[model samples]
Target: MDPPTRSWSIYNRTEITQRYEILERIGSGAYSDVYRARRLSDDLIIALKEIHDYQSAFREIEALEILQKSPNIIVLHEYFWREEEDAVLVLEFLKTDLASVIREAKRNWENGISVGEIKWWMIQILHGLDACHRNSIVHRDLKPANLLISSDVVLKLADFGQSRILLEPGFVTGDEHTHPHEQNTPSQTWMLQQPETIPESDNSNQEQITMSKEEYFKELDDLKAKDSVDETDKETNFNDGDTSCLATYTTSDMEDNPFKSSYSYEAESEGDRSGALTSCVGTRWFRAPELLYGSMDYGQDIDLWSLGCIFAELLSLKPLFPGTSDIDQISRIISTLGNLTEEAWPGCSKLPDYGKISFGKIENPLGLEAYLPNRSSDEIHLVRRLVCYDPASRATAMELLHDKYLNVNPLPVPVNELRVPSTNNGQDESSPGQWRDYKDMDSDSDFEEFGTVDASTTGTGFSIHL
Candidate 1:
């Protein structure tokens, strides 16, 4: 037999390029462990992710190619393979995740959900997802764990391992076709080879074949234009920090094709969509309905569903759907939203996994007011729309970002407030520029703190050793 796969522990120290120091292990995942590191060049904070598999390393690189440009997405500084160990990816470090926030919220209170906090968090995540979808990149896996918040309060969407570029039609999917590096050449064995079965017809919202490519492209273009308008403010970076210079970061440094090709997913069994690349989202708890049934071709809408679930979990401190199995997951959703009727089941028939399933007849309609108490009926109405079981009916990121509930009292955690400059040697490094400090601000504090800090101390902040 071949040698056993080598195991690397997160606690153990791992050397990097004989320069950067691995401060400590911050987090761990199935394929890699994330560590908080200090770059020796400037002693700045950074994250080092070590991936054991060579193939996974390439896939991460491919995903980053399209996703790295957006400010909402986490920044990837560098990536390299070590001759002695495995592949290493350098990233901007983050302190807390949305999952942590949800847990914290649960421990602090013994009552109903915090409507204000929930609304703000939901809007922030939607903004990020909106940016991702606008760029033709889909963060197929968007759960609380993947949303990172730095100590400075910068919210970034992390873990693009399952992300992919939604390809233009008539284009075949492959490793080389998708990745800009051209590391892997085209091979028939690698082509996306889904079964040639006709999709079941849905009388309702089945694939509207008449929707032309031009129309789709136009919609995508409009979305991008809207994001450009949003970014013109030059202040919001989804982080809770304030800085003189904008927090400039990139998700990938793909010098080649930005919008490369489509991803190639291998199949799990026969007759199923083989080679239909899946960004197989986590478990039923975090999965969108479309993902639970197994869709070969899906988009960023899956991320939106996860965002809604995470928002609910933050308020409830429990997963919105804690189903033991896929069927159970569907049951919980149908129970909450009521069984899919012909009105909302337009494209359901076309879905490969939409076979006969047992769902109890609807009795009581799920009232958002009961689930998410104290919120206005209007806001609750919006939340219901967001968490709908039907993917088509679910709120798009753009729509949610501009929702009325977000516009009302307790505005989003201002990006400027999130950036707290580090106090090195008892002096602020980012001072001398009239920057606002967020030292004593509470979780419920709003934009009123933007100009509250003493100007002299923080405005003078700027001490980069580099």
Candidate 2:
């Protein structure tokens, strides 16, 4: 098959070509394509992410810059952007991600991942997420695919395209307990707007304006507050409580019901602050229940729900809730954890599409124990903390780090002691050409082979299987 089309003219640019040897394309998505390249300056292997969407690029850049100091977060060396061109981000490259590790274990290990190794992975994930949460950033998309592992067996969080920095009321630094979405208005705008145009200049000499943490948060607060007021006014006449005026459903409504009401999940366009934050941001299998109900108003607790799903997958070497569509996703969730109700999660009825969608009540829900029969009680408790119906009751990353499960005698293994597969997709990485050939193959094919869906490719949601 012919190689996928390159939307960005990154290969032809003199500045990019001179600085990094574009080795091969490793991953692709609707708005971005990632390449495994060698830095010309230091011969260091790196990933060059060419993002076609200005909003996504800006968000990733801003989030990574704030998280550069954290060891568990991916390092953004630098980025290159110019007028009317795609942004190219220079990022650290890792041989494999947690998905690959899980796949390898399922194939090779007789008993699946060891308890100690699982603890190590969980510890790393918690640390990375703790760093993000501490900075008031929500990694809307968190799955095994996004949790990349380094050569030293260290896991770091990657792919911040869907991540949002909480600059609104409860999300400011030092206010950890307050839920971010409690007081959030429907008019709150995204902080990373299209940047002002810079004068035409050579890429090598382009200078970046770094904003201090204090100044950055201050500016974000001012922007969000201003946008909220302006949008509230524009929407005053149209903000009636009736939901009939919203975008109507289509023929595919049963398959993937589009969220288009005042609580629509569509991200606002460049100059349009009328749309609500998308609830359809994450992959289907790991998505939180509130998100499935089209709740645009949510907080970092959503990540905790995803963490529970990921942990369950690691234990069984199979996805806990591998749904095919949005509706199917909720069915699978209900089948396992019982039907969602106001008693379980108070105010859940206030969710955008909560009334629009309905499900038969499950009389006897099979708990996590049904899926993880042989697992230890502590292990079950660990997943239980984050997989509950109430978002407020979900455990935080910091709190889980100190849990009894992680502090036991068979504690988490050292980073160096953790095992990682030597080869990715049967390609020996010791050979540069072989590694390049492996990376050149489309990532979707690999995902299909493993019965997993790459969330990056599907703009909607995704799933995973054994």
Candidate 3:
């Protein structure tokens, strides 16, 4: 039995007949089922995130609206809800996610995705994050799978279910009983009738929509060329907050989850469970020290720490701090970052849950460079600034964007040239920065589906498996 809420836009195969041609189930996560559906109007294929929980769906809708103009943030097309049925979100369809890309890169190349690509992806993420911060929103969950890539290879931030608005009024307000009408839609209705960001077989709009090589390199040089960071900025450090990132703040499942289906149940309160939100948030691998202390008052600084962890992972091809539990997470952080004292992290002993964990007295010489020996020193320095003990010292998204590493000689591959984990065919489609002709694809299907698609050219018969 369905919950007494709203009707699902395209509940089953039958519902998609005239409205949308349901191609396949792209994915299913904790909150909703993501599908690749083709709009019958112009044969435009879009992603439908069908959500059963209205609150989660509502949050994502709200965030997307505020972040619609953000360069690398995912674009929302239209949204609707049918009471007692489901809430359907119409969004630009993306080919694969960063997680799938990472997996495919590891398979194709033993070393994993290149450093330039990592820097490129991070720059895009920072732009999206900066946009979120400017809009007073916090994406509590940031992971590989949540970052989707278009067919043209542009990366965008997706999945705002766990995001929180820092605006004065906060998430939802106003009278609940007020019925939604055509003129007066719900607060989450943010539909923009703009051209689809992710194009399908519509080659006519390729040049304008596709990410160009010049644009790609120019964007990479943007942050660095925009400003300068002094020695004080680089040396700024503190340790007031405990460095134990409540990696398992909510549950053990957050250990290395790609923000897919981790949050199944609520978490027990630890400390200072008042203010903006609870302390139980973030994934194990990318959590910050202050978050581990159950500090509900923490701000966007926590995200910088997570970004550092992510940046390090991208370079190393594995998580920098792979802690299974809260205590283990803290220890891992301390071992890599070294123990903190009151002199460094002022008022460290005063935190609510301080001294609850222990670690080695000194740090290991086999530091970040041990795994990333070949990477530029500047990149390593940037990562160190991000994963610092003091949240106050961590660089903001905008600041990190200006780091010199992004402007280095080996520029990131352009969008058309950037290939992902699931899309790596043995054949070279074109030069690194150019795209393959859409007409040449085996006439089997209008679009390609990940995971199940076979790389065979000689076969006579064809099949489309969702």
In candidate 2, how many Å is residue 29 off? 2.2
Tell me model 1's lDDT, rounded to 2 decimals: 0.50
Candidate whose lDDT is highest: 2
TM-score of 3: 0.66
Give candidate 2's TM-score: 0.72
CA displacement after TM-score superposition, residue 348 of candidate 2 (Å): 0.8
Candidate 3 per-residue lDDT, tens place, 1-466, comes to 2322444346543444457766655454334666666888898878776765444555676677656666588878766553344567778876666655655564567767776788789888888888777666777767665677776677788777657665432322223422111111232222222333533344352222223334433432342232232213322211011110111112222222233222321223321122336555555456677867656667778878888887886776656775545555665666566676676577666666665433335634346776566777887998888878877888988888888888776777676556564431221323221112211111111113223332332243232211
Top model number, TM-score: 2
- Angstrom error of the Cα, residue 422, model 2: value is 2.9
On the 0 to 100 scale, the lDDT of residue 17 in model 3 is 48
- Measured on C-alpha atoms, candidate 3 has an lDDT of 0.56
- The C-alpha lDDT values of all candidates are 0.50, 0.64, 0.56
Full ranking by TM-score:
2, 3, 1
User: Lowest summed lDDT over 10 consecutive residues: which window, candidate 1?
Assistant: 237-246
> Which digits, one per residue and each the tens of the lDDT, describe model 2 over residues 213-245?
465445444544433123434322111111110
